[model samples]
Target: MIAAISENDIKKLKEDLKQKGYKLTPQRRAIVDTIIAGKGSHLTAEEIYDEVKKLCPEIGLATVYRTIILLEEIGLIYKLELNDGCSRYELANKDEVHRHHHLVCNKCGSVIEVQDDLLENLETEIEKKYNFKIKDHSVKFFGLCSECRKDG
Candidate 1:
């Protein structure tokens, strides 16, 4: 099941696109809505395309791919490479202070969201030692999920 997106979020997204000189057309809206609906699920381009096609039959795969790339470039989404040979994406949270990690199930290919900011210490150490500024990061732990471990 898809999560419900708030009207405020939709309005802000529309304003963002307009500021970027991109019109929020029906196809674009459909694509964004699909991504927002699958909040926790890291959906692949093909998966997103399939979902968007249900709303806009005339939308093409290339358009979906392009839009995904554009959204990622604009920091509206995060692209993840979970070592599954397929790129997945999730929406960027409004509060950038708390970033979430991922627990990927190797057996079933399920992606679980881990909300703990486990890298705060590491990030602080790296910044202090290297004199570098860290803007963002992503972490993924690959292992068997509960059901998969039980079956094994």
Candidate 2:
């Protein structure tokens, strides 16, 4: 797939960083670029830090943590805390459909994005039937994925 980080998006991110007085250091920019380079794939901070190391080996792990936290604070990305104790992050694409829910393979820890509007509609119906307003929510469907099922 084409790299998810488009020139327009990077330009906008640069502008946002500038307005916030966040220093656009080479390492920081490279880290962002690298993260976006992964496109739809969610990556942990350690994975990101390791990739950044190839480009700038001297960069510290703490620097990656700080930068990711700052970026998340600014709403540039979404941080997902998996039950596995590792946090995976992906760039926030405002124009696309929100990939909010997940289908998790309990055996393999494989996460698949579930972008089903029907599920949302069902939730809405349930809320209306119960005479309650539904706020934000997250759903994880856990079962053995195809590979795991085949293995068993």
lDDT (Cα atoms) of all candidates against the true structure: 0.87, 0.79
- Per-candidate TM-scores read 0.90, 0.81
For each candidate, C-alpha RMSD in Å? 1.7, 2.9
RMSD (Cα, Å) of model 2: 2.9
- Give the per-residue lDDT digits (tens) of candidate 1, residues 13-120: 778888888877889878888998988878999999999998899999999998998788777888989898999888899886755898999999888888878899
- Model 1 clash pairs are none
Worst 10 residues of 2 by lDDT: 1-10
Q: Which stretches of candidate 2 lie over 4 Å from their true place?
A: 1-4, 122-137
Best by TM-score: 1
Please tell me which predicted candidate would have the highest lDDT against the true structure: 1
